[model samples]
Target: MDRTYFVYMMASCRNGTLYVGMTNDLLRRAYEHREGLAPGFTAKYGLKLLVWFEQYETAHAAISAEKRIKRWRRRWKLELIEKLNPRWEDLYPGLVPGPA
Candidate 1:
């Protein structure tokens, strides 16, 4: 079965702590982070804002992108986020589906 993979960036706040992750289910994973269900760096630092994300057709490509971005300099990551979200707004609400 075909499945989608996502590379997403979460942050505590604008110019705050950042976290990179990959998941098959973006909403669920992001929710888990938001709820502090997965205790770790994100929980410790409160990185609940989804600053940026990209979808991939292949798992390999998604994994590669996530890995590469995780190693990037903080300034570069910030620039990437600003390109998609100038104000560093929480994108989770926008991603959620509207009522049918």
Candidate 2:
């Protein structure tokens, strides 16, 4: 299988908190967030819905993008998501399949 890397943004819900992160395995990392598996800021802030994501060929690139996004203000982040995901929907459910 080909290795994939992702710089992703997760939101608590509509017009809610946002979290930025990077991972080599997008699916696994997304699942971790959704399941609240890791005890960290995301869990504490209830940021679990995958609102936006960008794929990269290398983990370094993904990490860089993640850092850039993290530095952005909340309003800027919201604008970014709104540009692609206007509804701010939980994109994770659609990515995996079955019931959301």
Q: Highest TM-score among the candidates is held by which one?
A: 1
Overlapping backbone residue pairs in candidate 2 total: 0
lDDT of 2 at 43: 90
lDDT computed for candidate 1 = 0.95
Error of 2 at 85 (Å): 0.5
Clashing pairs in 1: none
TM-score of 2: 0.88
Residue range 4-87, candidate 2, lDDT tens digits: 899889888988988888888778889999889967988998888999998998878888888988888889988889999999
Q: Model 1, range 47-90, lDDT digits (tens) per residue?
A: 89998999999999999999999999999999999998999999
Error of 1 at 73 (Å): 0.5
RMSD of each candidate relative to the true structure: 0.7, 2.4
In Å, residue 12's CA in model 2 sits off its true spot by 0.8
Best-fitting candidate, scored by lDDT: 1
For model 2, which pairs clash?
none
